[model samples]
Target: MDDALVVGGTRFIGRHLVAELLAHEYDVTLFNRGNHDNPFAEDGRVDHVEGDRTDDDALEAAARTVDPDAVFDCVAYHPADVRAATRVFEDCEAYVYVSSGAAYGREDIPKREDETPLASCTAEQATNDSRDSYGNRKAEGDRVVFAAADDGVNAMAVRPPIVYGPHDYTERFAFWVDRVRRFDRIVVPGDGTNVWHRVYVEDVASALRVVAERGEPGEAYNVGDRRIVTLERMIERLADTLETDVEVVYAGSRELAAGGIELEDYPLYRDHPHIVSTAKLAELGWESTPLSTAIDRTVAEHLESGRDGRGQGPCRDDENRVLAALDYADR
Candidate 1:
């Protein structure tokens, strides 16, 4: 794609995607609310349009002005948003939506591009509620995009699971990095056997480009590691990568709840592993980023950014509360 437009390109995967686009010699245009510090605002190489993606009028105007060959959407949530955005991108040769793996009906079995059932979504489920998880809503959005294939939008979806790497705002990986550091002892809920699936932010960005350039329209591809990585195994990898000496403490759920804490308090603690297959993406000639590489680079970035690699966990206080309870029990 010689010219392309990205919706919401300021942070995380979007930021990395923009960099990938530039690397491929594609002139890029970014459309967002201009509410945050843009890493690309200074680049003379890109066309910037500051507007709301849901705002039909503004998007249509920008679409006419930029006239890109392919459009990548990173923040589209609801079908309503997709409908509005596609109306603006009607003429683009390719429309790539960045969706999440949560949309799958089942994560236990290895899922393909089309074999898996999509989580049900209703228009009423549009409002944010725990009943309508993001996975189901993304399925709704995916349906909307593929439905537009009839209108010749050349649409496709790239679903990624738990994307982590540099510039991650969620602090998921940072939680591990910090836990490896400054904690003489680390705690994990349960036996730490939960399934973990994730992709590097930059690799996801690259896969998006491959999707935009070569993916079959009206289809979705899973972009992540084919080999499943368990929570405990990854933690062991983290300790090895950071060269940290810490004892791992496994706590039961009963005690955690009694202490006003849950597995959520312990970062990356999950009851089930999110097993996903990237076989489809691999078929498209997209290579998955090694977990070891992703971990090293992420830690290096966190350290280079002047972060002390200490106490970055979101549930630090809650974790301490739970840990204190465990310590009391030991007494």
Candidate 2:
């Protein structure tokens, strides 16, 4: 059996990737802190190894024991993390690094796999900053992983945009869903004209699996749905799905930024024209799930979970203040 080791396999995209790998008949070993229960415990194909990827000694010990044919690094953030992994698994057959589209520094350029001028920041500075530091760190991480690849050890990176689905913790899209379900008046940032590229979590998982099977060594692929949707249209679609009538209100980006409202806090900001092209992945025979279908499935699953109890509850005093401030500022 071809053995695979997945770091950070207990959550979100990592869980889905592990499932896909098992389905493809790859013997899987997962490494995490094991604080969270394995969602795939019943699958019976996974071997669990508990360790911290940041801990060199622990990671080296786990890598020696698993000695996997390939390593799918699902949660490498800092460039130092990549350097740490290289120290441990220098001889692994394949090192698949899960990177982000944020790696591309050019806000002027719609992100593509082959694009140059990759954004990067020193690892030390990245640790303190939040907003743009993530992409910068990921770019550095990608560089380290690709540089560390060898003739025997193939390395590849996957850059995915806003991934959403069942276990989504970001709740970025969920905030919109909840809002649309309650009120017909939708408040958007910056004319709701930003173009967003979103991919279903399942599609992202499938793409990773395909890349593991056939992706070229030392190449990076952008995996996302090609269809672009504006913030207004996305909300409209959500309203249509929920059978709700809503009014769309647009706000300037400057106003929202000045009010200290984070773009991630609202759905509209995600629509900004930072679109990514998947031409390379398409050539690799990867297909993406339709945006509408993905949205429908996600909303339905989120509603059915009924974990949305918080949506209907009374807003706390501070929460109400923030919402009121946002509304006042936007208006």
Candidate 3:
């Protein structure tokens, strides 16, 4: 497809996706509410369609204007959004929706695309805009894509787990990057073996483009790092990237409770490992960025952006209390 229309192209994944599409020589137009600043505003290659995606009229107008060969929906949080988008661009060569790995209902060592059961969404959950219902709603959106495909719409879905890298506003990963860059000794929740699969933002953008060109309709693909790492290894890798040495202090429930903190209070801490299988995406000529390389870029951009990730997790004062308690208990 030579022409593409991206809905929600100004932030995080969507921003990188626009770049990817342009790199592959696709004429790209961004359709958004104009709430956030457009990074590509000055670029002559990218065009902007100012409108809210929730308004079907505005969306239809964009479809009529672009008549793009492909459509990518990055801000579809609810099933209704996906359903409407697929309908509006049903004739496009491909319509890809950005889904989440959380859509899987069951916990497995590595969640696969076809085998894993998806979370259930109710009428109320579908309409309610809450983080608690995010997975359910995303799963329902995948179903909507499937139905659209069955009706001859070239709709596909890509599920990514815990995406991180440059321009990550979530600051979830930044919390650890900051911890390693700023401190000699940092508290790590659990025994440091906690596993939460993460994919780099650029890889996600490439996956969207690949799925648009090569993926089959009515199908969903998982995108994540080909190799997984534990929480301890992740921090160690970060320290390596920053050329620093620090002690990784493990804090359990008891140790954290000394500071009135719970393991769950820490960001990226999961009792059970959350992993997704990427063999499917790999088959479509998709690969992930190396952990070390991805880390280097993430840390560098983080330093430049000056995002401390303070609001993303527990405060340092609280962590210091936990550390002091650990020190006392050790003595």
Best by lDDT: 3
Model 1 — which ten-residue stretch has the worst lDDT? 307-316
Model 2 Cα lDDT, one tens digit per residue, 193-289: 7777777888888888788778987789988877777778888988988988998766555545544554455553654477788899989899988
Whole-model alpha-carbon lDDT for candidate 3:
0.94
Sort order, TM-score high to low: 3, 1, 2
In model 1, what are the clashing residue pairs, if there are any? 195-273
Candidate 3 wrong stretches, greater than 4 Å: none
Q: How many backbone clashes are present in model 3?
A: 0
Error of 2 at 221 (Å): 0.7
lDDT of each: 0.81, 0.77, 0.94
- Count of steric clashes across candidates, in order: 1, 3, 0
Which candidate, 1 or 3, has the higher lDDT? 3
Candidates arranged by lDDT, highest first: 3, 1, 2
Per-residue lDDT for 1-331 in model 1, tens only?
Answer: 6998999999889999999999999999999998878998779998899889878898898888899999999998877888887777877889999888888887656666678888888667765656347888888888888888877888989999888888887777777777777687777778777776778888899999999888987889898865567777777888888898777777787867755766665555556666567888888888867778878898888767655423543355666777788789899
